[model samples]
Every structure is written in structure tokens, then in C-alpha cells.
Target: MDWSEIIARSEKSFWGLLGLRMLSADSKLVELGLTVNESHLNSMGIVHGGVLSSMMDQAMGTLVTAIKNGSQGVTTHLNVNFLSAMRSGELIASAYPLHETHRTMTLRSEVRGEDGTLACISTATFRLPRDSK
Candidate 1:
């Protein structure tokens, strides 16, 4: 399938609201890119936890959808761990499958900072479509 279609579909979603780009998508993984800006900063001038969480959430969902071959799913649970903080520059989230059953998929994601530091680690569970095989 053409990955552009998947990216275009995200243009109107919350991911777009944060200015994230769907950089790449494979059957079992997905990557998103973002450049930190003032709007994404907290009062301390650091990237807010919410922004990191949202990036993980989007990465998990995008990976699940790609794995399902466009049959998307909803997040059943999300857990995030903040390893560090950042003030600016580019960030990327690389999400890959941790496990998958007939009804759900769990993903492990790493959010990397501009200098390639591990900013956050997230694990998310997604409910497969009702008719998913």
C-alpha cells in the first residue's frame, strides 16, 4: 500500500495539531518526526510530558494501523516513562511491535532527542478492529 495515503489521513488528526510528520511506515513499525518549538515547551522551557506522550500514542497507533494493512484500531492502554527532557531541535519516535495476539497489539516506542538521547520510553496496547483476523 502507498504510505502517502496513511500520512494524508493523519493531516487532520491530533498529530497534525502538534506539527508531527509521519516520516515512514512499514508493516510492523512506524516513525514520526517533530521539531520542538516554543509552542511545545512548558513553563520551564522544556518539552512538556504531554507532547512526549502524544508522540508515543501516535506512533503506536500508526504502527498498529500499518501492521493491520489499513484496518485501524483504538488505544486500549498507554504507559509512558520520561527518561529525560529537551528544550529544542528535532525529535523522532521509532515504534515497533512488542507483542500481538488475535485481538490486540502492544508496541514499544523510543522517543529520541536532538542529540540521540533517550527522552522517553512508551508502551501502548491497541484493540484490533472487530473483524480483524
Candidate 2:
């Protein structure tokens, strides 16, 4: 499926509530954005790690979906590195392909906050469904 359809379906998901926007989606790249708000903050008054992780994971998985020509998949593994703290601003995540096969795809992603400061970096592997239909 295209990003538009995926995002449209996401409209009622937990991630969708974060107000993520699909900036780009194609074979080579996938980028998404979310504006930080009170609902996204952690106890320390910064964007929560889970939120960052979720966005990064989604970015990578969506990229894999695009690269797989619309095949559905789920993240099997995700590793994240928190580089900086974000108080409030737009947070963006972008992913690029690292490796792939007929059944699996690996990708690297990064999250940036205001002024393009790096907030998190992540690597993920997505397992495509065995049944395409």
C-alpha cells in the first residue's frame, strides 16, 4: 500500500494520535514528522523515549513496506540510541535501507528535533508477512 493509504489507516492508531505526517515514501527513503506536545512528553518534560522509538520503528517499517512494493510487515527488532533531549518542537524521522531479502528488511533511522538537532538514532528489522494476500 502507498503511504497515503497507510497513513489514512493510521488515523485511529496510537501512533496516529501523535499526529505523524508522511513527508516522503519511496524505494530509497521514508520520512515522517510529529510535532511535540504535552501528550507526548515524559515525566521529565521532554519527548518520551517510547514516542521516539515508535516513530523511528514506524519510519523504518514503512520504508521497508515501500521497498517491498507494498508488502505488509512488522518490526522484529529495533535498537535506539537517544542522542539529545527535546522539549517542544517538530520531531522528524527518516529511514534508509540497509539490507533486504524476500522475507526480511533491515533499515537505519534517525530522529531530529527543532533546528535539526539529532534526538535519536535507530536500526530495525522488519519481517514481511508470509502471505501477501
Candidate 3:
């Protein structure tokens, strides 16, 4: 399947609002890229936790949809850990499923800076589509 189509469908939503791009994707994994700018910064001039969380959620959710053959699901829980501060530069988030059941999929993700620093780590659980297992 053309995973790019999944990202294309998100273009008009918050994904587009944040200028996130699809770096790569497959049936089991998804990677997203974002260039951190002032708009993504917090009061301390560092990347905000929300931005990191959103990026991780997007990647994980996209993976779920890809594996489900384009059926979308909703995020049920998200946990993010900030490891380092990011002031600027590119951020890449990669997510893949860690576990799955009939109703839920849990994914693990990491956001790395351009310099290859582990800026954040995240894990999220998405509720699969009603008709998906």
C-alpha cells in the first residue's frame, strides 16, 4: 500500500497545522519529520512537551491506520518522557507497535534531534477500529 496516502489524508488536519511530514512508513512502522520552529517552542525557548506528544501520537496513530488498511482509530492513552531540550532543528519521530489485542494497540516511539540526541520517548495506546482486530 502507498503509505503516503495516509499522510495525504492528514494534510488538512493538525498534522498540516504543525507542518509534519511523512519521512517513511510501512505496515508495521511509521516515521514523521518536523522542523522545530519558534511556534513549537515553550516559554523557555525549548520544544514544548505538547509538540513532542502530538508528533508521537501522529506517528503511532498513522501506523495503526496503515496496519488496519486505512481504518482510523482514536488515541486512548499517551505517555511522554522528555529527555533533553530541543531549541531548534529537525525532529524525527518513529513508532511501531509493541503489543496488540482485539481492541487496542500499544506503540513505543522516540523523538530524536538532528544531532541524534534522544529528545523524548513516548508510548501510546490506540483503540482499534470497531471492525478491526
Q: Which numbered prediction scores highest in TM-score against the true structure?
A: 1
Count clashing residue pairs per candidate: 0, 0, 0
lDDT per residue, candidate 3, 1-133, as tens digits? 6666756877889999898999988777799999998999999999999999899999999888878877777999999999999999999999988988999989999999999999999998999877994
lDDT of each: 0.89, 0.87, 0.89
Candidate 2 per-residue C-alpha lDDT over 8-109 given as tens digits, one digit per residue, 9 for 90 to 100: 788889668878888888889889999888999999999999999999998888887787778868888999999999999888999999987878888999
For candidate 2, list the clashing residue pairs, or say none: none
| lDDT at position 61, candidate 2 | 80
lDDT of 2: 0.87
Distance from true location, Cα of 55 in model 3, Å:
0.4
Candidates 1 and 3: which is better by TM-score? 1
Give all TM-scores, in the order shown: 0.94, 0.92, 0.94
TM-score of 2: 0.92
Across residues 53-106, which tens digit of lDDT does each residue of candidate 1 receive?
999899888888788878888998999999999889999999999889999999
Order of quality (lDDT): 3, 1, 2
